[model samples]
Target: MDTGRRAGEPLVRHTVSPHLTRLLIDAGTAAGLDRGQVMRLPGFDTLSVDPVRIPTATIMRTWEAVGGALMEVGGVARVMELWRPGTLGVWDYLFTAAGTLTDALRASGLHFAVIADPVDAIAVTRDGAGVTVSWDGPYRDHPSYPLIAEFVPSMFQTVASSGAGRPLTPVQVRLPHRAPLSHAALCELYGTRNVEFEAGAPSITFTEADAATPLPQSDPALAAILNDHARITVETARPVVSWLDRFHLALETAVGDGPPELARVAHRLAMGPRTLQRRLNEAGTSWREELERLRQRRVDQYLRETSLSVESIAARVGYSDPRALRRAIHRWYGHSPRTVRQNPD
Candidate 1:
């Protein structure tokens, strides 16, 4: 029985393990971005070095900020340049330790959510002469979806090639999103000239021979240990579904579209405004407090992560008046936006 495929309620919110975010941070730093400065930026400053779960929105925002920075310095392709084995910790080892590429791909389907998110986003299937690994889920709505879509397939290819102990090119690579302005770097990285975009989903297919290649690092004992750790992590880290989580999701969904309106959010959640307020109060928060917190985080993110002017950021965060935004920043952090941007930590 494939217990990993058991049906369950969907998560009200999604989370990513910290190492993925660390990968982006490391890649940004390798591309010449300041580690301290990037880490001090709003969405990243709070992340722990330990393997705690990070909110998907936080990771998304950080990727957007860092990916943009990397593009200016050396192109986002630098992330692949900085990649190496063991970057994913137990997850990476699980693949290399598997008896064969086939086994590694199976383990990926089983244990991926232990390190990534949208629990069942990865699907491993046999296609006559090829094996396909698909990544598609509720990730489309994310602001960082395009980067995530591109990153996942490229990262998977890297990991699979490392496990196979050879440079194994995909049979084909398909992405659901529109092609980027310049996907030549992506084509070169994926070892293909034309990567299909606007596909049904994000997937990579490998020839059956490549899928069966024995990894040089295969050790059943190590594989067992890593599998145990992954299973335990997946079981214990399953996110709890609750109204509070739902509320947070609603708020995130409205980010950048505008300030999250109370009535609209409540409607989305299938509850009256009063009921949503009551639920928040029960959860030891309120709409105003939550909105303010969201605003403050966005303000910090923009101030420190990018070169966007204050007036532009003010409008982005739904602050029509720059002075009002300044006052709010002062109230939130006891410092001007400039000071916060300069000394984010």
Candidate 2:
């Protein structure tokens, strides 16, 4: 009960992740609108679209637009069904983070899956003495063990602090695996001294008083809305065919006014050129090759299908001189541009 003095201070606010932007686009698609159309919808065109997060207000406005459009079929519940856990962006630090716990509980039940497994979810429970949050799911050797192990206790600390209005350290912390690297740093980061390394199931335990304390910042209404949105976002999600196709789409979007370079295309995709190159490498391709391929197709089209002079066509495809274009054309085909045009293949 002694949560260090001041009682009426404000809590931190967290922004929604941009993944919800993808969700809004999905909602538009469900209502038979293309992404461009949705982006063009008032209050959205000016917003900078990121692949990770977007403004919560923009999400609300987008929801109004998409939700309104879909009202004819079945209203908000129809929209809610399409929401997924990934779609629910972190609302705020402890406030929103706690809601995520509730949302995960709603989606996964008592047990939370550290990774993915619809049938055998993770368990989060409480008993006569204290509360226990557990993730004893089947993925013991899951790649996310380190991440989830760190995240669970950190989150409990957050929920406790927010609920008690002070830094309420956990009474006990347990890890499913060995303590992560940089052990000294972990203690400093978690600021907790009662950690049990390799406790098998990775759980957090808080005193009965701290666990029962009210999170005044908690808003059940907002949590319900977010949970619904998260569910719906997952249901109607569309998968990107491949990184190459995604790059092509991003490139095409970048070249709206004229020819676009690799940097410009990378910027449009919300990544730096180096990061883009690495991702492309993982996809077994290179940016230079993709750009060259796109240019080749455009150049061939200009030569065969359009009446633009060869010099003008050269400029359009990024060549400075007609001679350079001619040399490249010869490299592409054994004959001159005129011969290729005449042959029409």
Best by TM-score: 1
Per-model TM-score, in order, reads 0.70, 0.38
Each model's backbone clash number: 0, 22
| Model 1 regions lying over 4 Å from their true place | 1-3, 6-13, 32-34, 41-46, 73-75, 237-248, 254-345
What CA root-mean-square deviation does each model show from the true structure?
7.2, 20.6
Tens-place lDDT per residue, model 2, 113-219, is 11122223345566664665555443232222344455546544554454345765566777766664445545644566777787877666666676665555566
Report model 2's TM-score to 2 decimal places.
Answer: 0.38
Candidate 1 C-alpha lDDT tens digits along 1-345: 122651221431376667778878888777777788777654464466444555666566567567656766655567766777777767777778899887887887777776676443677888675888887666464435566677778878888888878888888888887776777877887888758999977888888888877789999998988888876665555443345656776787765565558999999899999999998898788998888987776677667655568888777776667898999988988998889889956
| Ten-residue region with minimum lDDT total, candidate 2 | 3-12
